[model samples]
Target: MNVQSNPVTASDTNARVLSYAEAIREAMAIAMQADPTVILMGEDIGVYGGAFQVTLDLIDRFGPERVMDTPISELGGAGVAVGAALTGLKPIFEFQFSDFAMLAMEQIVNQAAKLRYMLGGEAAVPVVFRMPSGSGTGAAAQHSQSIEAWFGHVPGLKVLQPSTPEDAKGMLLAALADPDPVMIFEHKLLYKTKGHVPEGSYLTPIGKALVRRTGSDLTIVAGSIMLHRALEAAEKLATDGINVEVIDLRSIRPIDRDTILTSVRKTGKLLVVYEGVKAYGVGAEISAMVAESDAFDYLDAPILRLGAADAPVPYNPDLERASVPQVDTIEAAARRLVRREV
Candidate 1:
């Protein structure tokens, strides 16, 4: 019954549930209304309503001038957005797919990430790159990939992967307000997932993680859709006398090391799960963070990571389902970690 999301305001007592995509669009609409400098640039976003239809009809309200669509050039579009941000306009650039962002690495990793520091804070690139990520929709390898780990490695770039609709909206608004460039990877399957979202503007802290569920036996860390799966697994494992703690790692780059360390210290067992490739993913980073910290002394068992198999996203539904950790797999991993260690 536990949903992983930040608490809403007192004024949001009557907050309504919105699909993750709708919440994102609402955030952009709010930002655009409040700040004339806010603009959106992406291919097929205007008339076509974006590749996933997340930007549907924004052009009708903001008009083509503000919600202008770009050509199928990720590098060129990203360059323009970065350039726009340099000149003081807030541009939210949406990549058609997370995979396409690699084509603009020079702009994202080299230019946008370093300009503020390289210019000695003389310029701020308040650009938000919205990427529809993950591989649940049968888009296959080319269109489906969870490569947040790639840019998460890039310094000076803030990377966020929100699991809930509330976070999806709040985090986007927060990124728009930040001076540094932020990348938000929206899992494709989460677009239709709904959750309560507060009316009006708000911000979810970028670098913090939320302890979704508390337990004393084990800690399961996950983000994006994986967070939801972790929560489900935790609930099921509770019936088997294996209580598992779950942490929603909202931000990938600036991980909430303190929360993770504290949980591992309490639980003494860690299971890191992600939708990315199993080897050298964010799970490894968390494992290393715990292993290198004082939390290592508290661990009753060796830390384990559960992520996608070492292969491209499969197009077949059943194979795709097997490619990544699911509720059953997560439950099994948690049970194994707890029973074997605790």
Candidate 2:
């Protein structure tokens, strides 16, 4: 297979609105067309067009050899992708649900993550693992977990969680270019969400955080679907005289500590909101980062994290909503923090 020596860059013209899933598919298609070395492998991604249909019609364009449909073994599929990456092919492996990654831990962590280091820079694994994560579809405890933090904790692996269609496309392209293993956690509920996406290939720099809204009263750090909720809460809080800054943490690993620290220092308060479980989640690490940094001195109040309850995601819609932080919950938490109540 042929590999494009030149990198794909952003285009200024021909921008159009597209859904999150469409943006992701567009990124993979662009990469495959540009570089024949890039291929896709996952369950039902061919005829079924993927569990969420992100890979729809890719097989028709790229053919079955490049757009392969593997059996129902995530471990086996992941292993194959890792091996392919090691052999100079860029493979995008999809996991229907992030929770299923538990079964592929040996391949992901032990093999894919450690191979480059074990080879002492002689080898590179250009594999991108896309996982549909989060707790919105009522798929129950098994399928609804937002487990990005689990992969983020590992070394030698870059973890990304894109919240918007623009970032979804940009980050995927960026991940395809990386030489090391990269894990992308795509929030399941954001699939149908629409936004303006650039027409051609673009790269959203990894390890950089985007400041969605700037404010002074408090800083709300959020990722994935929770970024949308935080923005909604920010709007409601604005009317209440609470000026809130919302930070969308696009990349989980190699987090933008400078952006987070600067925001917290300016606001004098930090509220980390996420859909992952409360204990030992991404929020905890962000809170610790600020608390351990110079930003801690600027805090007028204690750092607060609003995350999902310390329980499995419930299958019931109502129960699911309550288990995780909602718009109201985030707004109330920001209000309480500003008032020195919490």
Give the lDDT of residue 246 in candidate 2: 91
Across residues 1-342, which tens digit of lDDT does each residue of candidate 1 receive? Answer: 225354422227678989999999999999999999999999899989998899998999999999989989999999999999999799999999989998999999999999989998888899999999998788888988999998889888999998988889999999998989999999999998888888999998899898878899999999999999998888888887788888899999788999999999999999999999999899989999998999999998889999999999999999999999999999888887877743
Estimate the TM-score of every prediction. Answer: 0.97, 0.96
Task: Report the lDDT of model 2 for residue 226.
Answer: 91
Stretches > 4 Å off in candidate 2: 1-14
Give lDDT: candidate 1, residue 287: 91
C-alpha local distance difference test of each model: 0.91, 0.90
Model 2 pairs in collision: none
TM-score of 2: 0.96
Kindly list the per-residue Cα lDDT of model 2 for residues 44-115, writing each as its tens digit.
999899999999999999999999999999899999999999998999999988888898999999999999
